[model samples]
Target chain A: MPKLPKPPKPPSYSEVRGTVQDNVIWKSIFRPGSIYRKGYRDTSRDRALAAMNNVLYHLHPVKVKRHGLKLTYTYCLGGLSFFMFILLTITGIFLMFFYTPAAGAGAEIAYLNMRELSTTVTFGALVRNLHRWGAHAMVFLVFLHMARVFYHGAYKPPREFNWVVGVILLLLTLFLSFTGYLLPWDQLALWAVTVGTNIAGFSPVFGDQVSFVLLGGLEIGPETLLRWYVLHVLFVPFITVVFLAVHFWRIRKDGGISGPL
Target chain B: MSDEVQMDQEVYDRLIGEGKSERIARAKAKAAAVRKSKIEEGATLGPKPAEEATKALEEFRSSRSGGGGVATKTAAPADGGGGGRLTPEERAARVSASLGNGGDSGSVGVPAASDHTHRLLALVPPAGIQQVQSKQQDKVYTWPHLLLVEFVALLAAGSLLLVASFFLDAPLGSLANVNEVPAINKAPWYFMGLQELLAYFHPAVAGITIVGAAVLLLMSLPYVDKNPSAKPENRKFANMAFTFFLAFWGILTIIGSFIRGAGYEWVWPWVQGLGFVL
Candidate 1:
């Protein structure tokens, strides 16, 4: 290829290398500067890059001051809620490899996993059990976390956005618990969900509209299992992940946790 | 103005007076001024629609207006830390710095004894300010203590649930025949509160009001009780009120679960009765 002409540059001004006495304004909105440094190749690193280049990331600081990361400011309950969630996620995935969602086979498969596959997996039942309990624990912890945050006034200023996000997380948690209730495909799961979805239908604004929508029928049937199974396994988890991102980000942006105790 | 500023001003004024120079700082400013004058010249004297007025108000809010004013001057010292924790070296240094060479220095920059004490007290603010009140207030998870508790509790609950699931086996009644009504048709524990409501009130009211009230309380709690004084001792009134509410709801839920007949009308009535009785 033939040599192409270089684009013309702006005319140069006299360079002022040394510090000047006057504070002259430098308007350089057009040409941006590198404002961030790279970090360890973990979560914070992704955050820092995101903070600079992304509004969503910018909402949470890439690197938190060690002081803010301390558990006391976080009110342990929220952290514990997250801990339970991770525990649930791990246990849930393991349960999935063996457990089927089909009404006929779901509970049977779960039983087989507990009796047979569990022996080889060695704490496999422990895993399924943990996942099951973790769901319940998550609901309890999330409620307690909301209470703690509420009483402490931690949900006010700076943390308001996160509080809204937390509400969604709480709803998702309840969803997670409810859906997990059905995985065993037992009567408890069946009735619990039937009652739960019926209550959902009671929403006056939507009412019967809501039940038919979620249950996929006026009453619980094969459709309910498949629906709750999909929601528990796929849908709610996806929504929870999105809200979780906003939740943590808002924490950092809300001034790296609350203090002035 | 300084000599340089005056010189620059006169040069600029002379140039402007001669109509040879123009100055409106940014392109945005120039654009705004032109539009403003155009509007003023052709302005109609009429009341605007509410929506139009709202749009105007929003446009005003979006514009950045900078002006002159008094700035609040409560300059905090570096390291907004209170004087609580102390190192030997720091303590010695601070004492020496305050006392000043063991009284050799005439004016140690210390105030009257009362004033000195007040200043120091102000820094630490007694036990009231420094203490976070409840352990929950600190929110810090001492991992070992917390994790152990979490694991144990979760493990225990998990174990119990598993055993219950196995032993109870969740009563596989007929294959969920919707057409055949199961006698004593009832809701689960979690839904018991609402189901009990459906018995008395319209399902619309039961669903909307009950859940709405609970969600409103939970979500807007931070807004409802916005006091910053969360110290347990300081927040005694709020703490007590909250505790009472929690206890009331908890007691009612348990009781309502059993006496499903009255359908929660008694729950609120009793709570109201207690208020008047007290």
Candidate 2:
């Protein structure tokens, strides 16, 4: 009988991993100093290079004051506020897929969309819950962050301008939340917004004009819904992001984190 | 300018006698002639004498002390106390002796007083140099240190939000009807404090003026409080005022959200059920 053919041997895990890591495509994906690269080690040079070569370099410096690492010092309020904003954006996008900004007269597409979103779509209710709660959390966090900065007196000297930027960001956050509140088109959303916008109508000289501009007519309607939807998803967020960039840039320019005191 | 330069015969002869090369001696003699002409045209040369510097320092110290200022003592020359003039060679010998080199054997190549022909390469102003006022601070790399903490914070917040989302469902009331108005209409919780203010003040005052003024004050806090200190002990009033504002707002918000019922009147949440929504 002829000798049985030997079964071919498979490549080892390490060999396959090595081949994948050494490929041109992988090398392009991870820059020269990336810790994800094949030869990375926990050396001082590699650690610095990891931060320097990454996209996060824009937000973080290569090194930070050691005291900033302490949880109580910052309570991580500002970072968490930013994280909540990101969370809300993601969840807001998911909701936008199922939502329609139409309302008024015979058509109530916006209200219909809200009902179907909570009932029919997969994970819709969960995402909506996260968006709502995260928005509230973000507003609360931003306020707490301001308070933290005040108590620490981190708003002194070179940081004073950044504090003003921060206040603007806080106002933007509130506007974002208020606009989103009206999107649900429920009694709670409509009347809450009516009460909120009525305050804008009280602005001394331009009261009537501002109210008309906000409502798109004399009161809440399909036009108002569309206008606010754009503000919530696009206009306000765009402005907030611009200010966020400046705020983070100033933090680095003004000598990193504040004091041990 | 080159044609006008004339070599000083006396300087050339002295340099030659001191064993300098012909090229160096000739260059030095020409430079000396140029310097002499410049001096004749009113150019100043060299620094003030050590005695003058010592006298100025003494006078400054005395004036500062007389004005109740802290007197700063600098290291004045050991032999400068006599206030007597010394030749360049004697001064060089004293400097060398102070440095533990001493006498002619280790004289450090002091040039003669008349050697004013030495080239002036450049004059750098004091302001041209950088002054480092801050000392070294304790720091750590951001990659594993700060980024790791941030990652953990992100995970914690994300997980908490996820758990909340899983357990709780967002509220959805009946469709909006312009014809129907609810008995207890209120703003979102964040604006509840302002809404609560509506009970006591006019809408314009409670809503627009007060809110606007609060925001303006918050934005201008840094400029307003001119205190330079970051320490809490130095800013008691600022802290107290802010804390009071927070407490006032907090109380109003709580009253508006939980303790108020139909017609915006007060009622305990335990009895009326929560009239608020997120």
Candidate 3:
């Protein structure tokens, strides 16, 4: 198929100037949010409409001023959380091809798949290893990301809802990782989960009963694997994705990004 | 005018370093040129290199990101894959690699060449950048308003998490026999932070305090960093206190994990420099 050339829109002078003004070179040194267009000169009856249109300017007050996306403080840690998520998704997809949600064959299949990838296929093992490692890494990053947020005080007032959402995300992430462990259907996975759930059993008063409901029996077997598979594959992802959407949206609602201090 | 230019040049030299601005200018020019030429070539050729290049970059990025191909986070090393502890040479290699191999002579050679307009920006004064970039190797950070080092540390943490995940993938071998036990068993990394806390605090405290603290802190981040101290000097106390906490906790955890084999005998508190961890 041949490519079609589209006509370029005629440029507006002010728009062009704005683009030039917004360049990184200019933004870096100039404290952001300052020297910005205060708004259209026309106020009158259109003031409310104008303010509503100015998402960047009005949703959060201009008074909650801060620097742009400085890397060290919040953005970096946030970015780190994002990066780890990407890594997990990549490795996880590849693993799914080899993994089966059966307590009996799941672990055996995982081993076989990995072995085949190593012996027959060249880079397949690397991919699996990378995914496995990435999953573990996400948990650590999430916590550190939390630590950064705490020390920085980014969870106060207007951003409190998002902060709660973030905590849920962290729990969901741990749950996701835990569920994945059971899918391997190995002795270690079974027992670790058994011990892990048993610890859950220690929570409050009715812990053992709670774990039993989850496992669907007295032990970590096929039912447990199935439950874990469902949790990892369906439940956790759904919640995390929804929470993330809300979390990011809240940042916009509260303000673009917080200041560094 | 000449004196002002000299001052500006001096500032630039300080912020990005003497050769860096020139390097950036050259790099930008080279890139524009390369891109313009490629579009021109793509217009004449069968397939556009722009799309192909993007696809290729994405592929490379995904591979580098980790084994996961689930998309959405291929570039975030900490989130998608563990990239902690990049050596200096490794970092240099990464920087040069990111710049990509410069093209041969001509507009098509570098991406910056085809650009028609360039302007001097007073927003980020060259002098300040020069002052900051010059201190690249200095332990005492003199950040010129950009939080590069902090982000680097954050990225390190993120990457490590993913890497830790990879290492501990399917930690339990193939058997759902709740009765079995693996010899060198360990919890997943995130839980390890909690699990490790078990050794330090009583179960009640570990369960309620450390775990609770982490959860509470994460929930409170948006408010925590909402202060107007985007600038480091404005952030000295927060930064130092955080650094101290991180140092104490991080070092203690590392020792706890590695020295686990030594059987909890050598534990030491970093605060007292001796007994706290014990």
Candidate 4:
């Protein structure tokens, strides 16, 4: 009564006469044939598969035109600008962790925090330098990208809307740089922003109001620092990221970097 | 017969042969056939309005009947009447019609003589031509090529920035004091061009009016220019205008960065200065 039929055995690799290797242990670390799952064929097909399967690669088409591939044609200025933006974002976040944006804290305290960050925080100096240099580079690169588009006569017809968006992006990039200029609370940052905001003061009917809104007062001080802080850290960055997404999407829609008409 | 009368006759004869009454045929022919000239004719020559043509045709027919003149016997071939050779008179009339009309309306397989008409037609292309252009145009995929170029560009820029960061610490002056102003207070480098403009022109003009106007104009360039050509060689005026703008910005930026010193005074780059130098 207690004797039951032997349970059916599960299939084993040995039954298939395949040599058993410890591929399972290695499989956890490396995916064997994950890319060539359907079986490797020609290079062209593999390249196509690589582009189709990968998220980043798929943003591009399967093959670029020969002229489009020319380094000088685009100089990849737009890409450099974007890459620098990403670098700035990363390093900027790191700087923020150590940054103190107290409105009441005198520029002395603000400057002290920067010094402390460089001396105390690990890799803090590198992060700060990267953010600063990358930001400057981005400004230059974006301008170069615009120049390239202009000279290539790429803004004609279908690309008109994208060009307008790009112009807006250019203005936004400037705003980003200007807002960040006030963060260090150093003399250069202070006077530069003061000069910039003063230019805003010259707007016809909005002059006084613009300056008042920007500086939070008649002059740069605690409130100005606070306002600039929020803009640099929150508002400007958020807007930039949104516009950046649109800009990249437009590049694809506008036929991927302009070449000969 | 006068050329005009002969053309009207040939066209009317062809149209009447298509089972139309003489009055109706004359009106239809006038609406459809273009009169050829040394230069290409404009598109305004189409058949007259139905009411006007009918009225005019009725007047002509009544006058002809009143005059008691007999209508000539014309050999108007039926549609697609292949191998029906034209009589000598018909052949001469057809040849003369073709020559007068530039062969566009009467002859099969002969292209229109006017390039301008083809160009005008190109403005509203046939749908099939659009697909043909896309197929024939040289194009490359964006996959490996675009992505790879982007990757290489990023790597190069990143490396250069990394190196520059190590050598050049981001500039930070003493703590800000609203009570005091820096000797060479200036806007960011990109805005240096406008700032330099402020030096020469009134702030309102330079800062607000000029800059604002320039930006608006730049934005409106594509619309206002209205030239369909993209090639620089074909657009000399546009190219020169843009180049002038670029040169102005470039020159101003340079002057602001290197030439201008404390209190916005001019100084050579090599001159000893107590402030920022490019």
Candidate 5:
């Protein structure tokens, strides 16, 4: 029998071969090895590699114990807190574009900016609300996460250091909220911060100095607004990010979420 | 194979750091390697001969029972595991070896599941995961399990905030006038607890001493309690104490938030119209 003509073989992907398909535009984006090969075994090692190789996924363990994954056990309160932080960061940046931290006239410039943001700027109110609510949610969720950790006795033994770090994060969260409280320069913001700073004034030794430093003077005025604006925008976020990184790294060091004994 | 051996060494060292016996650690590493090799050889490669399977199971069982292993926790060094007398120098050597050769310094904290839990839940893999032998428990890859859940939560929380933002603008009271402070001025809900404390004690006592003491106590909990176990049942006293603290915080916050009238006076929440509810 006469042999049929052989079909052409596909060229290889190597640079040496210089295949047309290899130089295709899409190939540049989704390179080989980016996705796992088909029929890959879900073995323990494979799972470990999957987690270790990814950036975001690296926060989690390859194979968590069933007990640890239970919604009731963790309630994902820590995750919620983290999500709120991300939301606040994004919305806070959006807010900074419009807000002016100046104490001008009866209707303060800051208050006018806020009013404009709420009533005029497109989706401005949404961004402001998200920031406001996210702040509240983060404060609530951080405390809830702490409560969950306490209830589960997860702060014991190998996990002790992480718990201490978490407590510090909680304090940082409150400071973030308090510093942010004065940003709007409204009656609510003014009196709330005054009440808060006045408490600082009662601290005996450094009370007056502390309040003075916080207000940038003895009273809540332009200096106070400027000081708070810098704190809310620049200083607090930087410190929070640093501590957050440590808090997460320590969790990975102390073992995945604590489970049954 | 070399990579697996390196990983095994890392695990063994970590276990040792957690106070496990060398013998038990070796057995666990061996069992894990066996499981890995079996997975690498696909199930279609053919079933294990009955005699070999029986022998493997018997060896695994013996190694576990003989080496003082339990379901969830490894044998405690102070209790059942041998090598409780491991010299400090030996431990330091093991730590250095693991740190040097493991190549996994940054990759710690994987909780190897308890053998009993693994065996019982080994029947079915969680959704979206590739199939492996059932010897491992019902495990799901974290990509889908954790990250997916987090993404969904982000969307849920974001949308909720979106709707809320539309209906309820963030509160911005009239422009600041220090001389005309609102009659019922109060701090945010969170600081309301502290504000309530201020009403009861001197500002120094309430703000600095009491609040500072609470924070310090919280930070030093693990050191102060000294309980090694993570189980809730074993931590009743600590739980009760925290519950009381939370109750105090909650009640004080409520008083500061709602019960206090113009002069920070106590008024039943019902006295105010339901419209006063936040």
Candidate 6:
């Protein structure tokens, strides 16, 4: 009645989204050809550019053999193994924050922390469980992946070196799992590691030296726990990552995802 | 002074006999002398004859176009079209017309042809340059195709793990007692196979020899099996050997994990209850 100024029309969802995507920050984050970029179309050029521009390009090519998309071809074992490794790393890091590596007769901080994880901490027990199960799954998946590669005879010619690298990666995965097995600082952890390391101690020569270095003493003591914690969290993972990089790089270089056979 | 000039006397005399100008004859003779000297020195000639080059280019073009007849001809007619006689402007117009840019004066200026320069009508043979024999593969874009599959796989694995984690708890036995030991002390399930081997073989043999041999054999598989074919039927022996190894290890792991009890003795898992924990 008083001839008041009309309110501005609200922006549509797409309009607001367009404005957000048009900004410098958004453009910087999602480069041209990114699926997330503004005005992205489902074109061959954009699809290829998306893969090329993303960090995933390191692991995947812009196009893959059509046969590789078949679930039966790969069972996605290799990718799952890598994903499991990443999951374990995340959960392991979470566990590491609440737990201590120290262990002895009077000082069993590691064990106490584990108990606290179950009883006191939120999602700690779940993360621990995930880490444990994910580790076991990774070992299994890596074994399956090796078998898949072998059965396909994907190890011939230019792939032979990659297969060797894969073998190294498998061994490293096992070592990572073994080192981590000792971190819970419980009877299961201690005895399991004892049985495993006892096998290592039976190596032809340098047996005692190997055992000593591995256990950090005559037996699985406080020193052994600390040594294994460092190995599990730092040393073995570092080595595994380096080998994993080579393994993945070789997969792409050796002509991407083996064969239709 | 004429004897000291680096010109082929025979070529000079021949061109002179053909009634060529003194400057043109001398220049042609000098080039012929240089070419002869290079040939004598075993220096390979750079460009092949136009006919040979055209043949190679035609072969390459035919192969690229699915092995049909030669595409459009680039070579000028031998008798009628005097490529050498054309002025620079005329040459530019001819090139533009041949390139299907006819009457487009806006096209970039073509480089003027020099007196000695020949028009490049033939391409280097693709085979001679680079023999990349990549067969066309049936492929799909990785974004929606491969990345989608990968994302789904990751989600499936993550959800499975999450559900398992939610229902089950990770085992945590009593504080590690150096004094007392568990009766059924076992390694993790993966190493359980090796531990099972320990019961049968001597420690050194089981731990070092068998394990080392297995790893060495696995690593050397590609090199050892000289079978180039990936077909299962073609590589029967390799497939059989690897299958045997897998079955052997798998059986051992199963036995170690489920069939072992106190004192690491064989016991039915159903009877003794599982002596294993994840």
Q: Tell me the lDDT of model 6 at A111.
A: 91
Misplaced by over 4 Å in model 6 are A1-9, B1-130
Measured over all alpha carbons after superposition, the RMSD of each candidate to the real structure, in angstroms, is 25.7, 13.6, 32.8, 18.2, 20.9, 17.2
Pairs clashing in candidate 1?
A: A71-B139, A71-B140, A72-B138, A72-B139, A72-B140, A75-B139, A76-B139
Instruction: Give me the candidate number with maximum DockQ.
Output: 2
lDDT of model 6 at position B19 = 100
* CAPRI tier for the interface of model 1: incorrect
- Writing each residue's lDDT as its tens digit, candidate 4 over A132-166 gives 87888889998889888887888887788888888
In order, candidate lDDTs are: 0.57, 0.88, 0.56, 0.73, 0.76, 0.87
Could you give the DockQ of candidate 3?
0.14
Off by over 4 Å in 2: A1-13, B1-131
Which number leads on lDDT? 2
How much is the lDDT of residue B62 in candidate 5?
49
How far residue B169's Cα lies from its native spot in candidate 2, in Å, is 0.7
Chain A TM-score for model 6, please? Answer: 0.96
Q: Per-residue CA lDDT of candidate 2, range A1-261, in tens?
A: 999999888999988888989989999999977987889989999999999999999999999999999999998999999999999989999999999999987899999999998899999899999999999999999999999999999999989999999999999999999999999999999999999888899899999999998889999888999999999999999999999999999999999999977
Q: Which ten residues in a row have the lowest lDDT in candidate 4 chain A?
A: A30-39
How well does each candidate reproduce the native contacts, as fnat? 0.19, 0.89, 0.37, 0.76, 0.78, 0.94
iRMSD, model 4, in Å: 1.8
- TM per candidate comes to 0.50, 0.76, 0.49, 0.68, 0.68, 0.76
lDDT by residue (A1-261, candidate 1, tens digit) is: 999999887554422322221123331221111122212133433434444444433433443444445455545577667767776787678777776655543344443444454457655556665575556567777878877776666677767767878987987887777776765654445655665676677786678888887887878766777788789888998899899878887777666656544
Residue B70 miss distance in model 6 (angstroms): 42
Model 6 per-residue lDDT tens digits across residues B1-278: 55565999899999999999999999899989888999999998987677665565445434533532324343554453333243354455456655655434442443333242444554567667866779999999999999899899999999999999899988999988978889989999998899899989998999999999999998988889887889999988888878889999999999999999999998999898998887
Q: Tell me the tens digit of each residue's lDDT in model 3 across B131-250.
A: 533322212111212234445666676565546534543332443454545544544434444556666766557755566675576455555655654455666777686677667567
Q: Which window of ten consecutive residues has the lowest lDDT sum in model 4 chain B? A: B114-123
| Native-structure RMSD, model 2 | 13.6
